[model samples]
Target: MTDTFVALSDPTRRLLLDRLSEQGGLTLSELSEDLPMTRQAVAKHLAVLESAELVASERDGRCKRHYLNPMPLAKMAKRWLVRFEDVPLGSLSGFHAAPAIRPAHHP
Candidate 1:
């Protein structure tokens, strides 16, 4: 879980995940294109994501293709984020709406 958070902490890793989400099965070279960083830098980011189980890669002949594995993120959301959806924000004191006031008119 910590690994997942750590992997998500970096903007570059998040961008890599977004790219993979948009199009799965992309090679390191394909993922590196259009980015300011070098291929090796992207690979390092991918490595962190892979360690968190957020990215999965498979070798295709001579090249390795990377894909997004959303399970870890889903699991994290289910564990923490889902609970927020169940409880309405209005029910929470901090989120509760203040009473509307009416202006008094002078005769």
Candidate 2:
């Protein structure tokens, strides 16, 4: 989705998604802790991610928790890299295994 790519294009937003992937989910305050920005700023970033459908939120008691939605990401990758299925360009598993983009698998 265009929104998904637009949201992931930002480093801060990427960091937010990384945090969610690492921690499963986090509150707005929790997500802001190690970042240089204030919680409000992080919340703004979260808003963008949410709008992009890269993240979703729900209330856990008094706090609002945010979590990553990986499906859209996979869809984007498929749309961008799938090519012609009949052509056999191989799969993402093999593609991501390449040395050039392999480091992306590291934390």
Candidate 3:
């Protein structure tokens, strides 16, 4: 869980995840293209994501293609968000209690 958070803490890693999400099973070269970082740097970020189990890779002939594994994120979100599900919708909405009334004074 901590690893997942840590991996997501870096913007580069999050971008990589977004790329994978948009188009799964992408090679490192495919991912690195148009990104500010180099191919090696992208690979390093992918490694962290892989360690956190947020991404998975499969051998594609000569290269490995990376894919987003959303299960861990889904599980974490469920754990964190499920507790709030029971709360009243009105509380979450813009339904604040009324303020106390005060008498208007003439200037």
Each model's TM-score, in the order given? Answer: 0.83, 0.75, 0.79
The pairs that clash in candidate 1 are: none
lDDT of 3 by residue, 11-107 (tens): 9999999999999999999999999878988989999999999999999899999999999999998999887888986677777877999999999
Tens-digit lDDT track of model 2 for 1-88 = 8898899899999998999999966888889988898888998999999999999999889889899999899998788766765564
Instruction: List ranges where model 3 is wrong by over 4 Å.
Output: 86-107
**TM-score: which candidate is best?**
1
Choose 2 or 3, whichever is better by TM-score: 3
Give the per-residue Cα lDDT of candidate 2 at 83.
70
Count the clashes in each prediction: 0, 0, 0
Ranking by TM-score: 1, 3, 2
lDDT of 1 at 26: 98
The TM-score, computed over Cα atoms with residue i paired to residue i, of candidate 1 is: 0.83
